[model samples]
Target: MSTLSRVSNTMPTSLSCIDLTVTGALDAATVLGIRQESAKAATDGPILVLLDVAAVTTVGASGVVGLLEVLHLLRARGGDLRLFGSSAALEITRLQAHLGQVTRIYGTREEAVDGGLGPGRARHLAPGFRWHRLFPRRRRTLGWS
Candidate 1:
């Protein structure tokens, strides 16, 4: 028997913090649940998402694939996804290595959020790409202070 737990909390910056606890097998059903929860949490367009997988005991290949898909969807919408905790987990480390620079892993939730895990963060952007070009109307439309 396996267990999957998901809890989501919204941050001050509208970043959704999802804490996932996976014990035993992680299947496609669990992944779907996670995706649905994330979608519910992000109702106002693209937004930064922080995943806390510290309590995950194991990750299956399908789970990894699902996570990658989620990451891609978020990034394509001008948003970003960051993973925190589980640094010592072999599955997480392997996934991080496989994903290379595409994935950002943090040691703590605060570090992940405070480290500029959102849009308009100069550090997160690629070289030669300006924030205005990516989000010209975000500040005006979103009233981002």
Candidate 2:
């Protein structure tokens, strides 16, 4: 079986993040593999698994469900899973009620490891936060095609 995590059986890498990248459709079988690998990696100690989903071609309910299961499994063991890649996929997937509330989706590896906008104030002050309506696209598409 291909090793999905932990290059060494030594101590240093035990508590570090395991980089696991996946491609193709984020389907049942793929998620199952992820879950199993994560389970194995977490067995030794609380581990941080950085999942790269940039190459993933499709998304479905099963993928999201399986992700949640893995997240729960890790957190329960005092570990965590931070996902970085395919902002669109990560954003949509993470936006699911519970997923968004629990996990984070970063656009880059640095953001995932070092950190990014996280645990912010409940109130958001985005462009249209206080007022209603989106910033008219006209503002950005004034002259350009």
Among all candidates shown, the one with the greatest lDDT: 2
Q: Write down the TM-score of every candidate.
A: 0.62, 0.66
Write candidate 2's Cα lDDT for 29-130 as tens digits: 778888888888887889887787777766678888888898899989988887878746555655554465556666766566655644652422322132
Report the Cα lDDT for residue 40, model 1: 64
Clash count list over all predictions: 0, 0
In candidate 2, which residue pairs clash?
none
**Model 1 per-residue lDDT tens digits across residues 1-145:** 4566665654555544555555555557667776776666566667667766666666667877887787787777766677766634534545454754456566667667776444654445322345576577743556665
Q: Tell me the alpha-carbon RMSD of every candidate.
A: 11.1, 10.8
Candidate 2 stretches with Cα past 4 Å from truth are 1-14, 96-98, 117-145
Q: What C-alpha lDDT, on a 0 to 100 scale, does residue 100 get in candidate 2? A: 54
The models' CA-based lDDT, in order, is 0.62, 0.67
Please report how far candidate 2 places residue 18 from its true position, in Å: 0.7
**Which regions of candidate 1 are displaced past 4 Å?**
1-11, 14-24, 90-97, 116-145
